[model samples]
Target: MQNVTVVDHPLVQHKLTIMRDKETSIAGFRVLLREIAHLLCYEVTRDLELEMISIKTPLETIEAPTLKGKKLVFASILRAGNGLLDGMLDLVPAARVAHIGIYRDHETLQPVEYYFKAPADIADRLVIVVDPMLATANSAIAAIERLKQRGANNLRFLCLLAAPEGVQKFNEAHPDVPVFTAAIDSHLNEKGYIVPGLGDAGDRMYGTR
Candidate 1:
């Protein structure tokens, strides 16, 4: 898929494997998730535009290349997404943050929005939506839809793991929004969970389920 990017870096793959293990404790899983997120974030923003600016160093003034245009906006797709959000913030502290709270209806498997808050100038910045898992794509599609309704144009989706079905649905729903993932696992199960996924992301991260 043209819109999908899999960060296969050694470090990212290693951490992802550890995270996928059923024996990994909640504390350990959270730590590994954060570490993997940092690596994935690097790949997600690798193509950001840069502009030259004059800056004075300790010795002399010189032209320096800095990120161009408005500061980026990291949009977290609620609870589990925050796991990736926390680590990404460590890399780009200046970027604005947004939280999109959406949940899936258990029976219908539809998305339900509960809360959303984004930067006022969302239209002018690149918005990267973060989520730990992409299983059904219902929440992801709805989250991006909400962002667009609020005037966000430039957008991308980032996740720790993705199922092929979810990716296909997401691509069909929003072809313009590229997806970044550390790994794309097997198909989803009958219960809508990724076959080899790390279980419910929010549940695993919080030890709730």
Candidate 2:
């Protein structure tokens, strides 16, 4: 938990519980994911810099505080990452988006990128990478590596659930990139699934196997 933040608000916890329940319907799961992302977005963006600017407030002109610098970029790590995108976008409507498609090789359990696209001038903006589950950290690490290669420096990682092993590996790989998650599950099962996890977030969200 050194470089990780668990968003344990009552709302966040309640929504996460719904996501974890196998009996929950796909529509319900998707809705909860979006709702929880709204909360997580609030925590992740708490430190954004603000600058005072002159503004007219009905009667008089006063200095108003506004966000400084370029808009943030939300980088989604493939299919599952997209699940978190809509909710984050709902919170940061003006933020840019990037998509990185990385699939895990079943035999080796290594990440292999098939597609990557990002906004121009990423180096000058804050980039937040998103994925629903951080089970092995392979995809997250690889996605971050790809982002850095595209000149993205200021970065953060956000996810719905995280495993201890994944967090350790991710921190070791990219310590500068802080992690934000709703929950840190017990551990990963034999097949790299987080025990007591919401079970295949992408599948659950989209009703896909």
Candidate 3:
């Protein structure tokens, strides 16, 4: 069985703990979310392919390793994903961004897509779909499906937290794409929410409900 990575970096773990606390204010939540996203992005992009190029330095000419090909397309799964986007952009300011919106249907508990947009050249870019939580895996799966349909083949999923059940479901549904998360919790509730998931990510980030 494929397993999702639970990043154990001290900075990631510390920020995640603070964000999980109910007493953490919206401002604090937003700040910490971005900070953790940056840390997580660092780990996720560690294996990005690099190419060496000759460059002229002030003192002498030298060879330097730089990223090859098109910049990555950071697709945010809307609202909460925006928090992660801010931090990731700080690390790779040149990367393009795409937005996808998905909401859970209260009655069916399935994902409903409200918006989807991406770069026309998605096929050639490394696409990283991001969300704060991976609960039932419905939204993430749906988002990836849409990306694939739009010709995005090289892809990855990034989240702040994930549930074991969701990770299993996601791997089964789309094993080609690896998932990275700060932590993988126990299981999901019947309502499709991850247990102790820091509450509704959209609501927590936006100060709603």
Off by over 4 Å in 3: none
Runs in model 2 deviating more than 4 A are none
TM-score of 3: 0.97
- Candidate 1, residues 87-130, lDDT tens digits: the string is 99999999999999998787888889999999999999999999
Per-residue lDDT for 29-132 in model 3, tens only? 99999899889999889899999999999999999999988999999998789999999999999999999998888778799999998999999999999999
Write the number of the candidate with greater lDDT, choosing between 1 and 3. 1
Best by lDDT: 2
lDDT of 2 by residue, 1-209 (tens): 89999999999999898789999999999899999999999999999999999999889999999999999999999898887999999989999999999988867879999999999899999999999999999999999999999999999999999999999999999999999999999999888889889899998988998
C-alpha TM-scores of all predictions = 0.98, 0.98, 0.97
List the candidate 1 regions with Cα displacement exceeding 4 Å.
none
Candidate-wise lDDT, in order: 0.93, 0.94, 0.91
Query: In model 1, which range of ten residues has the least summed lDDT?
Result: 103-112
**Inter-residue clash pairs, candidate 3:** none
Q: Choose 1 or 3, whichever is better by TM-score.
A: 1
